[model samples]
Structures are given as structure tokens and as C-alpha cells.
Target: MMAMTQLQSGDRAKIVDLSRVSELVRRRLLDMGVTEGVEVCLKCTMPLGGPFMIESCGQCLGIRRSEAMRIQVERV
Candidate 1:
């Protein structure tokens, strides 16, 4: 498994773990359909270490770099 932040644009992965992040972040992710077993794709990454744009469950979300660092994912 690797941190979500490690994924480059166009990379596809499945969420495996969300335990490393705080409960608030976990809750928000879950609510956004970013739970374990869900497939996610790196859509876009801003320059200068900005938020990452990922697509999951037919929705796109921009997550902070800090939260992305804590999300674990396996390549699919």
C-alpha cells in the first residue's frame, strides 16, 4: 500500500486504509464515498503542493495534501 499523495495524475488505486488520519478527516472521507474498497483515480494535482483532485464513486473531490498523505491505497 502507498499513500494517496504518492499517486501521480492518471494513477488508479483502491482505498485500503484510512486509519492514519484523524476522526474528522475519516468521517469526511467516508461521507464523500472515499471508504475502503472504493476505487479512486488521481485526476489533477496543483502545482506548489496544493490539494489533490481525485475521482471516486463518480464524484471528484479535492483533498488537502496532509489528508492525502494519510490515506493508504493499493494500485488497481
Candidate 2:
């Protein structure tokens, strides 16, 4: 498993786990449909290694590199 942030643009992955981010952050992410076993696609990344855009559950989400690093996923 690797961080979702490590995935290349257009890569698809299945979320397996999430690191110990803050409880509120975790809840927020989960509320946005980023739970385990869900599949996500890396739609885009900022030019300077900033936030990443991911598609999941028919929704697009923007997350920071630090946040993405807590989301563990396996390539699909």
C-alpha cells in the first residue's frame, strides 16, 4: 500500500486504510465518501506539488499532499 498522493495522474486505486489524522479530518474525509474499499482516481495534481484532485463516488475532491499521504491505497 502507498499514499494516494504518490499515484500518478489518471491512476486508479482502491482505498485500504487511513492513517491517524485528526478525528475531525478523518470524519470529514469519510463524510465526503473517502472510506476504505472505495475506488478513487487521481484526476490531477497541481504543477508545484500542491493539492491533488481525486474522483470518488462520482464526486471530485481536492486534498492537500499531507492529507493525501494519510490515505493508503493500492493500485487498481
Candidate 3:
């Protein structure tokens, strides 16, 4: 598994694991349909190394760089 932050725009991957983040964060991600085995795509990232736009389960989310690094993914 690799950190989601390593992915570039247009990259596709399947969620492998979520880091040992807080319960609230885990719940929030799960609520948003970000779970293991789900495929997600990196749509784009903000300039100056900011948030990342990721698409998953027909929903688009702008996740902060720090949070995104906690999401581990494998190339699909």
C-alpha cells in the first residue's frame, strides 16, 4: 500500500488501508464512502501544495494533504 499523496492527477487506485487516524476522521471518511476495496481517482491538486481533489463512488472530495497522506492505496 502507498500513501494517496503519492498519486498524481488522473491516477487511479483502490483503497487498501486508512492510517490509524482519529475516530471522527475514520467515521467521516467511511460516511463519504471511502473504504477498503473502493476505487478512487486523483482528479487534481491545488497549487502551492495544498488540498487534493479526489473522486470516489460518484462523489468528489477535496481532501487536505495531511489527511490524504493517511489514506493508503494500491494501483488498480
Q: Which residue ranges in model 1 land beyond 4 Å of their true spot? A: none
What lDDT is obtained when candidate 1 is compared to the true structure? 0.91
> For model 3, how does the per-residue alpha-carbon lDDT over 1-76 read when each residue is reduced to its tens digit?
8999999899999999885556677788789988889999999999897999999988998878888888889988
Better structure of 1 and 3 per TM-score: 1
Clashes of 1: 0
- Top model by lDDT, which number? 1
Tell me the alpha-carbon RMSD of every candidate: 0.9, 1.2, 1.2
lDDT of 2 by residue, 1-76 (tens): 9888789999999999876556777788789978889999999998786899999988998878888888889999
| Displacement of the residue 9 alpha carbon in candidate 1, Å | 0.2
As for lDDT, the candidate ahead, 2 or 3, is 3
Instruction: Candidate 2: list runs displaced more than 4 Å.
Output: none
TM-score of 1: 0.93
Q: Give per-model TM-scores.
A: 0.93, 0.88, 0.89
Order of models, best TM-score first = 1, 3, 2
Candidate 3 structure, TM-score to reference: 0.89
